[model samples]
Target: METRLSLRYTGPAVDEGLMDVYQASANMIAFSEFMVTAVKATFGDAADAKANVAGFGKGSFITDLVFSVGGPAATIFASFTSDHLVTVLQEAFGLWKHLKGSPPTEVNQSGQSVSVTNNTGQIIQVQTDTLNLVFSEKGADSVGRFIKDALNQTGITGVEIASKGEPVAHVAQHEADYFVPVAKESPVSENVVTMALILVAPVFQDGNKWRFSDGTGTSSFSAAIEDQTFIARVNNGERFGKGDVLTVEMRIVQTRTSNKISVERVVLRVLEHREAAQQPSLV
Candidate 1:
């Protein structure tokens, strides 16, 4: 009952004016009376329809945008069909194609499915009987807000993410599409860039390079360190391995080859290590 959209932007540079225009369009959809009325009519009184003037389906909208100069800036937006809210948002974005010359590179839709791991190595048959929705990375305007608003609108008793012992809020970046120019000058040089990210997957050595998961669910990078001392520490002893939750600072070298800025590899450096504090388990 959910629609996921992956919008790709390919151009030289995305001017601030383009972002402003897209933001204005998004706001129009957010405040559109026709869309709100349609949602309220579809869901009816017993279920959807919040006390807020916007009403029904307003809580289902979630967007994430990642834009880098000289690269494809993509935005992912997810919505639900229980109240026809997702459709309305999609239509709103579609209007851009008619108004502007180009449209989004891709649009995708997927259903909700639960994946369970059998760590015990025992055969188990699971049947579908109950349904539940869990929200993570709580924020005022993120997925957490949508769930909260949906509960209030539907009068559904649900536990807030904070109540489940998670951080109530975190920094959030608003995501939307932008028009990038095709022939702009390079903004940055080939320098080592640093980033701090959470290690989601187990750090495993893949040949000479080590694969890493930054938990972004989209892009993953590989690490190659010239320093053999650190490699010996990890390979010989259990200094830092899988299941050890810690914040890592990584050094990345971005080299522009031809027209694209290519990130050759990332060097894993442990700026801070807290082995005892395992990764937070969201209930």
Candidate 2:
């Protein structure tokens, strides 16, 4: 499905309807990344999508891009027409603009309505659907920063993005920085659990996360080694090769800001290590 969107960059530099290829390419990459990231955030990770430039020209240096979805995303939108897709992106940009960069201080969902509290404790109410974009994986803030930062570069005085039949959402050059994602981190929850994890890939370097598979060996994840004794033993010549299963006590931390969700795990104790059966070498 193709949903058309337009982006117009206006400034003295674009007055001649010409832009340096290098700058144009940078802007294009940033914008395209935003589209891909936004789709995944709003529509869930199953979305395999792309925003292709349909047309571009001088005259304020505008470009028309077509959003197309495939794979699981198509199934998710089986009932949604092309018009619905356009509305989807429109809402994404709207919420991105509404947040202006900072993540909500608190969010409460009740039925189809939501209460969002900003940094200053100002409570604003919005529909649940309007927030699927901002309240998704990392929210729209992370994607907004990079795209807006790209526009802030060069001689871009302002930018406007819109889909058909929608009012233009404007971003002044000065306001580009206004979309910077919050750098602060807030802890959500933490817990310790003992499990046997098969090492997928172990980082040999200090202060790095080691990869492992879940106890059921069905999923994989990465965690840091906070067990000093285990690290010391490894440093002293302990072998923890790929496919070795380690029964460990791991502390899992869940953190988030308005931008995204983060989960960090630390191996607090290493209880057992079972090596994968090694083939005998014929001498």
Candidate 3:
């Protein structure tokens, strides 16, 4: 079913009926992804959701659009009223806000319902199937981070979710930080293994990952070099260019709740560094 919703922004960002195209696009994209996550988490794994903009209006800056929730479980969404979605968003944001700055001292959850007790002993509870949307995150996702960044931008004050031209949910400027997700748990596992990587790009910075890839086209990733000796050699003018092969011990860490798999590539040791065959210059 298609639910008409308007994302209206108010403040200096939309000055005189104008908003930066890039900023507007970023916010829209982030919100769309957030909605997609919310839909699946709320309805079920089989439910898919997407947003389509119909037009942009500028009383305070609004993108009038439709959220198409479809898939095998789409019927469930049809029965979900606009208020239901608004409640989900509001509660999700509220949960994040509480978790980040002033985390709950204790959380009592019974399936989809949760009761949180803060440091001040204040207890707040929310019951919704979408509670897990914000409940299970070690850190804010790139989408959530981007949305928070957009909201905190200068002149961008507030956001309101509306249906039928009436506001049903509101996110105030002061609440912008609520969208910034915080890490909740540590990685599930960390394993070290020796792997051969071909240098794709080199970083000379103090703390930045260097890009590399295996011979196969399947994977390319950036990793932090932890071999002090090898790094010292590079600092002393060791000529390692792109396509150079390096065999090193790399650390792989996996976090389940956030579904994050990261390569720290401590590069414990560089067993070998083979120079790629040089191509003749056509000068």
Candidate 4:
């Protein structure tokens, strides 16, 4: 079990640079120290620089380390690396377990997805959270075969399997166009939408109505809530004040008597809530 982990800096702001030369050098040296310590922990200094090897490209901020192990020993080493990396990085990174004789052909990471080509030349797309795993065409068939074989070994066979069926159906049903379709109300109301914004005014209750501004150029909006859930969470032992950041799900209901203004109904579904000190997302 060989675990590989990495981090890279890439952004549109080239002027910002990856890191200062001095800081880059310092980070690389610190990471190299960690690699050496990891190797020593796995092999108890016997392997040293021989079987447990680590190298860094000249003037680069990356390290390529490899450990040769077999059978249960490999599994132990992998578990060690997994835990070690998390402890060292404080759970800010993740590792890939590389089985002997089957190293990945390619590895790429992005803001939303991580793509890896397994040794068998099949692609695996994994989300950062590791909850959604998508295997390529060949990869999916290979996994299905493995699962079928496992089921056979346990005297359970011929089971139906499907991945991504729900998402496919959901998209087809919602996004597909048809001549005659089922009549239904829109999931998103006529003027209802979600907003993530910085509050410019303190949230205060006047009877059943709450008034606040989202710091937008447009005029502020007021909402009336019957459900106590939204305000309960907003209060959070204290009232939400100005400058706090929030993601709100609201409904835009037309006013019967007014044409110029509409009521924004708080749905009580606080998608996100944070203190004023938290920075608003720029991306």
Candidate 5:
């Protein structure tokens, strides 16, 4: 079974402490959603994917504030959920930390570097300095997942080439416009922001229709089957099949404020199960 998990930031009432804070919040939400989409692309189901300790479900899974105060500077807490949530989270955070510093410098090596004009009629010149692009290790995986998910969410499909063979494929590439950075500012009070995520995976048959458990009460399936398949792919590198149930979980976190509203940290939890029980076969 395959399922889709999504997150959307409705936008805050106030721009808040720093322009970056509001921006960071928006970016985080987008990034988190992107991560979920990536899991769906990789696992084909949210349930089959690994989840946080928190849990998973439908409706709005939100993290209003990880840490909040009346002031401009406050810590923020946030999280995301899906199958492979832990691994994805770890990678995302790692990348974030890695790229938190200054942007790298790039230079042109060819002689007679000349200025050129683009279709927009904007003049550009090549630099002679070495470029130093840095990516955050803290949220690397998460960010990658986010970008990956964003591409899949676009509804585009294709074949992915591999050394072993051709697998069902999808493509997601990042553009400069898609990149948003965390902002910096001092806080007025000790406010905090918190975030929570829910992963839901629906069960389905060959036709992509929802699947239900047999009346015999032996095998069971539910919304979480997708998540389970995700986790299975992460752990075993396999895809989910019919009659599987996905498990959903959540990850919550709170962090001390500094400048940005990025995820300070997160902890996960499992919520509910919609699958049936397994029974012995009748001879």
Candidate 6:
């Protein structure tokens, strides 16, 4: 069955300086994408390159490169299905953790504050030591893994069916409307299941206009709205506009023969007003 997984980048709108910082953060995200490609490349099956591939791959062979320019890091999505969904997702989590930081710190003790560094080196101290480590193998499994495993646990046995498809590609330009499947019905045949992942990014424009789309359609917000110093939502959609803030939210969903699981990673970016001074604003 087909399994889909998606990653999204959301944050405040962009100004020239803020764009520079987002570009730096994009490097780390690009590294994570590279790790995903490298892991999938090792699998046999020429079709494997096409099937379990990353968004940046092109040409005949799947390349372990991400080509999209950094612009308010966007979301990412991927999906696949096999009896070994657990094993595959486990490997993915291993690679993701190796590339990203360890799942948010887990506080054995409560009320104790800990220092966590953002993409920027600035260290921020939180009041609680109980960092919600969402993607823990023992705790809450990776969303992708959770979905895949959930389907597998149904106990309805089936044969292993494989298919050859093109390697997934990432969209270069931003879109306002897109569809990402969050869940799916049971598999038709035994041991077979299908799933999909959706990556979404919010875009805002000048005059307080904003929209949310993913290489598909566009949806507008009400008016230019500001929560704190950042623009929250313009019309009604999630995309950010020029002079508005942008936020990227990454979520992974997995579907198994019987169950499903999901996990999310959220990052924020504040687009500085081009006319504003260079001082950093509070988040």
Which residue pairs in candidate 3 have backbone atoms (N, alpha carbon, C) closer than 3 angstroms, thus clashing?
13-155, 138-183, 138-184
Cα lDDT tens digits, model 6, 1-283, are: 2333333222232211232344333433432343334324222112122233345211112212222212232122122223233234334333233324322222233354444443334444432211222222222333322222222322311111111342222221121111112122233322211211122223355444233223234442222223434544334554433333333332222334213443222222334322212468898
The regions of model 5 sitting more than 4 angstroms off are 1-16, 20-25, 45-83, 95-283
List runs of model 6 lying over 4 Å from the truth. 1-18, 34-38, 41-259, 262-283
TM-score of 6: 0.18
After superposing candidate 3, which stretches have Cα over 4 Å from the reference?
1-6, 21-37, 45-82, 101-108, 115-124, 135-149, 162-169, 172-188, 258-264, 278-283
Count clashing residue pairs per candidate.
4, 2, 3, 0, 88, 65
Best by TM-score: 3
Tens digit per residue, CA lDDT, model 3, 34-146: 66676666666676566776777772334333445556566766776656666776676666666544545777888768887756677768765545677545224643544
- lDDT score for candidate 4 against the true structure: 0.40
Provide the lDDT at 148 for model 6.
29
Winner of 1 and 6 under lDDT: 1
Tens-place lDDT per residue, model 4, 127-237, is 433311111222223322322222232222222111112110011111112111111112333465787756555544535555556666787666654446766665666
Answer with 1 or 3, whichever has the higher TM-score. 3
Off by over 4 Å in 1: 1-188, 200-207, 215-217, 239-249, 276-283
Lowest lDDT sum, 10 consecutive residues, model 5, at: 127-136
Q: Assess the local accuracy of residue 129 in candidate 3 as a C-alpha lDDT between 0 and 100.
A: 54
For candidate 2, lDDT tens digit of each residue in 57-133? 56223334344456766777566455554555565555555556777777789996777776877776765655665
lDDT measured at residue 21 in model 3 versus the true structure, 0 to 100: 78
What order do you get sorting by lDDT, best first?
A: 3, 2, 4, 1, 5, 6
